[model samples]
Target: MGKPAPRSFAPSPFRVYNPPMSDANPLTRRESEILDLLAEGLSNDEIAYQLGISPNTVKVHVRNIFEKMEVQSRTEATMEALRRGWIRVPGIEAPQVEASAEPLSWPPLESGWRSWQLLVLLAVFVGVSLFVFWPYRSISVKVAGAPAFTTDSGSAVGVVTPRQDAPRWSQRAAMPTARSRAGGAQIDGRLYVVGEIATGDTAALEMYDPNLDVWQRLPERPVAARGVGAAAVDGKLYAAGGCAGESAITNVDRYNPGAQMWSSVAPLPEARCGLALVALDGRLYALGGWDGGDVTDTLFIFNPEQDRWEEGRRLPEPRAFLGGVSFLGQIYALGGHDGVKQRSEVWVYDPADDAWTPAPSLPESRSGVAAAAEGVSIYAIGGGQGEQPPLHERFDTLTRTWSTIDSPRTGPWRHAVAVVIGPNLYVVGGWGGDYLANNEAYQASHLLFLPLGAQGLQ
Candidate 1:
């Protein structure tokens, strides 16, 4: 390799987003674990003891963490981690002190004191000490069921019944190619996956048939890119704005299944990747993304009839790798990263008013998530790392609340795409330490299974 050309601007210190940690977070799994311990006021030796590692190794990890996070001390690192939603502190209430009739004071013992008087004095002293300290006993009482470290999505406890409408996931046929940052679109009961971080085939394209549980390759994408945003409209799949190598690109390519050809459309006003593309009312809306150097708040809309991209209202907060979906004639942009931290804020865009409004925030903060709407609910899947793994959250539009849903994978699941077909929500390829070929299907409807004896009786 040759020396690379110099950049026009200085890169951000938090830009080392790659392998093992996904694209948003910068720390490794072990480093993140150590950081969590540091935030809990643990010394290096204590952290080493907890992780079953040498104290010197823990010190080295802490040094690397400091360098990566650009912090000089543990306090700064803890604050940065907390700001990024990388670690959560449980509700640790402080012990309250009560007022006494007299100030805590003691008079010097008189030299003429007798032996009986001295014994009485010692007994009184012991009683006073117990009375003063008794109220603080509850301070050491740990929060029951609270894990040493966990995400905002409260830790799971004793057995609980699953909701009838809760989404349940099951593994299906894996993709032929294992890759991360792939984009997906659902058309005609088939899901089309395009672009990802593969060895030499970033533009790899394949389609999955749910009923048959089979995958077949289609014509590959002409533009080699990952972190692309895709949506199906009018029987055609549109993939737009993703990182082509190290730089973000504005290329908008459309694929016609009937013709089996790819063609270019009007490019975006600016180059960006990790944005969200969703079709609402026959038009494609490109939401927030990262524009090479910084997270973008820009929104662009593409009209097929005009074959041009138009700039729309700026996002309430700039973000990338967010989950966007059209539900009940409105666009909902879910949790995403804003360069520094993962966001839990949910925003709803009204096409009629051309304005964005706040909605109920997600139960947990994440980015690179897959969002799909089924019936009256929207599912936000995966996109977590650090002290936490990717998880699922469901938004009940009718109730205007968010709740946790069951997920198949308990590890990092960022950069995946989701699409709903009938009663099932399918989450496609994403990164989990390494590139994944997982094709997991989540059933949104209630299902019942009969016992073997009951089946024989029937």
Candidate 2:
């Protein structure tokens, strides 16, 4: 490799992304385990005792974590770990760890008073352990098709049911204005519906609060478009390549959920509609869609570091009105249409090799199916050919096989969107018979599941 070109702009110091880290700087499993502890506000001695190791040994692991994560202090390491999904802080919001001129102490405490305090804390923990049940969120698993959880076509689940089948797809509060063909994705803990609404629907950005089972409206996207693609990365939602009136457009709109604001980024090279998008390795990939005149196979990738788009391998077949989801670190383009006919081909793209591979075809030729990945499996939700169905299928990456799962109650639909957050796979607005404002959730049964803030233990 040669010296890289100099940068035109500098990103913020707090920025973290999914760029491939160099293999030359790697951390062992033990080091990653220690970093997880550190993110929980554990000190060196506390981590050492928890893992049945010496304080000095834990200190060595912490040093290695700093070097590999390229962070000089514990706070930086924790934030980086969280951004990278290497660690998760459950039950509580992430603590604000501000930057300081001086790094923190190794164990963070010293001398006799702290030592006696630790001993007293240990005794209290033992007593509490015996009398109170620990949080079971960590050990529970989701059960598919639990009768205990149910939702109607247009109604939302107002209560949380504690049963053997914990994870399920229950309808949430319907959108105030039911519309379809809109772009949707989950950013932060809320689900955002963007893009084109039904002909008379005034609101462009609609948000759903799953916990409260209520709907609230947000500001519309910067650009007015239909047939756009949506994916959330770096905590920002990017809506790219949809139709602007009769012409296909290359315009891109970015919205920050935190600031409730909109901005622009580099647009796609080709102005296209009915595109599919997925976020992998902290980057965005825009796949096949329809130009104003014809369907296209071109693929463009967005690099956040440079805010630029680089063209990649073309799709094996030109597709539009398709669905896509990233599973096991690769993008899978599901069934789609070529202007006139629906397709069953399963095309997978490997970012590492920059190549496309054909996987098993859909059980049946279908288009406009919504997809979401959980663990190693990707579920193709309700979609079909000329006459759509309520049926969806599951594809397992590990086995390279496909199986038909019970269809969602959403019935036949097209242009729907699905996103995975925690254990629930949230499915939102699409054209089901007519434009829909419904939001439904799906979760795998008999699978290990851990949701944020789950209380009580088995």
Candidate 3:
């Protein structure tokens, strides 16, 4: 073979383009230069001119400097650099300063022009931070094309939004009375509230008409009770199992809104106070409560059609002063006291299978909280820590995780009750030591949670 033909020079497929290396560390060169310029009190424009670069480029470099230094602002950057041996005062002769240089000046850059630029950049940063870190707040919501009645601090507050200089709704109506430990149910567009007080139990039953913004007292409960468990089924409000005369009672009553009358129903198998009741499918399920003196583990199911009560699977652990809500056809029981200790354990009951399963645990142990389901999520609102600590917690049923919420309006009470109408959740009736009548409502500030494969609206 006449001397194998010289192979033509071919670039290797695996070779990557390699740029020419500069004398200094390219990753940090721009940052170092920017810091030096900043220490010399040179304006970005002046620094740009001295470095023969665009002011925008200088800005990018300064930003990199700030980030690499893990600082918030130019002042913070300077302080950090001085502390980290990255920069120094002129007279100090530090390792970073190789030659004599003027002392660094305040604000770093020229007064009028550079100050404006810095201010503009700062304003931009602040705006971005606000948009990123600020807590989202729900503005307005409508259900069935009508504004729902929302309660705040035991008062009826309406949503007010200006439309063409006209006030949409800006009036506050008085609540019947401050109620804590109260249970509420909505029937035929009317909201009914029952029982909640530590002492001098209230048989007072009140109904609210959202369209008229008026509250009227309905027929009083047949038996005076507090911490009562309640549910609405077939247009009738069922009140059952509450504390009466310093003892838990199994007295159950049903109220007919159309007739404005009350009738006794089959009492729950167990007398419980601070129990949670939810209407699911056509039956009512009662879970978690104090029976006489201690928390009970029994779960009771009431069939309104049959006028009977049946025992369902018991809770994994006995708990009382708890909060429960029906979400995605399942009953979720959140934090509550287990008689001897506070618990963060959350349990879910599936009626379809008649079984109880463990779900996510709460971030903190608490009891006497209130819960309500809106859309696909259940929110556990303010409650006392165990039989003590006054704090508030919230949980997303879809995500099965607990998060602390900013609840400046959380009352000192522990056994509060909650109900959801539209996008608002109202917490009512609780007791710290004394009976708390404070009624507070919280608006879901984030998007309504929709669980994966959820079939119903959340």
How much lDDT does each candidate structure score?
0.71, 0.66, 0.63
lDDT per residue as tens, model 2, 1-458: 33223212112112122223542326677787676555433345345545766656987888777878898776577656655645533322334456688876546456445877889977975555323322211112111231101001121111111112223556565565445456777877778877754332122787777777776667788777767788889888888877665567898878888888888899898887778878888899999987877888989999977999999999999988777988777899998877668799999999999999999988888767788887667888766542356556788777888987654453455667777766677877665544455667766543445469552121
Sort every candidate by TM-score, greatest first. Answer: 1, 2, 3
Candidate 1 wrong stretches, greater than 4 Å: 1-167, 447-458
**Residue pairs in clash, model 3:** 179-429, 180-429, 180-430, 181-429, 181-430, 375-458, 376-458
- Most TM-score-accurate candidate: 1
Q: How high a TM-score does candidate 3 get?
A: 0.57
- How badly does each model clash, as a count of residue pairs? 0, 4, 7
Candidate numbers sorted by lDDT from highest down: 1, 2, 3
Candidate scoring better on lDDT of 1 and 3: 1
* Candidates 2 and 3, the one with greater lDDT: 2
| Candidate 1 structure quality by residue, lDDT tens digits, 281-356 | 8999999888877888988999999998888888999988899999889999999888888888999999888899
User: Residue 203: error of model 1 in Å?
Assistant: 0.9
For 1-458, candidate 3 gives per-residue lDDT tens digits of: 12222212112111111122531223365667667545433345445545766656977888777666666655455445655545533233333333347865456576455867889977976565345322111111111211111111122111111112111112223344445567778787666888843223568788766556566767889987767888899999999877664577898899999899999989989788878888998889989787776678989999998999999999999887677888878898888778777788889999999999998887778776777777656677666542344555556666766666555332344566667654456555454433343345566534344368553343
Deviating ranges (above 4 Å) for candidate 2: 1-168, 200-203, 445-458
